[model samples]
Target: MAFKHKSTLLILTAGVFSCTPAWAASVSVVGLFKDKAIVSIDGGRPRTLSVGQTVQGVKLVAADSGSASFDVDGKRRTLGMGQSFAGGAQPGARQSVSLTADARGHFAAAGSLNGYPMTFLVDTGATSIAISAAEAKRIGLDYKAGEVTGVGTAAGVVPAWRVKFNTVKVGGITVSQVDGMVVETGLSVPLLGMSFLNRMEMRRDGQTMTLTQRY
Candidate 1:
């Protein structure tokens, strides 16, 4: 009788441990709304969660149409739509940058071009990254030596040079061999265009824009 009781206790303890759910290793916000969010855990199917609800160790703390806050494995993380969190990521992991829109609803990013500090205005309309002649000179770029070209602008056709940047970094995300253009005139700020944006997974939520490196 004593041996049977001990065996039963051990089996019950094993069963309890086996029933416990494993902690989630990854979480992605796919949808957000007032007091609700849709999240995917470990690349699984999306799960809809209300504020204060928990799923796969991820608890929704707060949510809105633009962003969502969650308690992920005891860490509070705010994520916009299409943003993700990877638990236990090692150093030098994948990079992502988040930008808030200005009062005028325009997005600007502070980054570097070939190690030179530059301010970039997010412009999806531009075909390539566009910089002014003066900016190129300030960055010590020999833009005139690049292939001569013409770019149309509000001020009409303007002389331009096609150049390839060795490195274009926006926040922690860095892209190499990015195509760009140097306009002789009619350009005020450097434009972050398709040349760089194409290499990123762009996500916009209300006034916030998130750029995640794809490679």
Candidate 2:
């Protein structure tokens, strides 16, 4: 009788193991364009899909430059660049900001520098966050006290001052002790450059760009 009970228990354990479900595929939006989106399934290589197209059970319903809508497991969802969906579970809390491109494809946002409100033009080509001398003065920045330097501009190499900012905040994201440069001339608006961008994971879809803090 004991042998019979042990056999039944082993069979039940095996049945339970056989009924367990396989791991659900994880889908992430890595790129988005007009009527098309690039997605990674199960953390695999990115695959591009057009509207109404399906790949690995994930379907793209509609897509624009800024956002994309999809059908997953019979659920309709919309996501911006860098967002993801997995096993019907929502993404975790992460510091991220989204920017919409203008008609000219320029991405800009309203942010603060050292707690002062300002506008920033996203310029990936720039090496550091750049501020104009006039704007710095208006914000009560003692730019002249920083190290004197030269920054190349459209006009030519122009006078500049290298400084550090206490904080740079954009939307809900904030970075501390960011490197910056105050251009003495030839810069009309502040440029958000690699100094800040290097610490962010950038994702662009059509007219939408997402910046997620990495550190």
Best TM-score among the predictions, by candidate number: 1
lDDT per residue, candidate 2, 36-111, as tens digits? 9997654434679899997555789999989899887678878889887655323554566667776656667555
lDDT by residue (1-215, candidate 1, tens digit) is 00000010111111111001123245678899999999865444467999999765678999999999989768899999999886642365556667777665667766678866665777887767888899899989999999998877666677889899998866556689998998887777678888899988888888878887788
> Using Cα atoms with residue i matched to residue i, what is each candidate's TM-score against the true structure?
0.58, 0.57
**Which lDDT value does model 2 have at 102?**
64
Model 1: residues >4 Å from true position, as ranges?
1-92
Residue 156 of model 2, lDDT score: 68
User: What is the Å distance of residue 150 in model 1 from its true position?
Assistant: 0.7
Candidate 1, residue 45: CA error in Å? Answer: 42
Return the clash pairs for model 2, or none.
Answer: 65-205, 65-206, 65-207
RMSD of each: 22.5, 22.2
Q: After TM-score superposition, what is the CA distance of residue 28 in candidate 1 from its true location, in Å?
A: 32
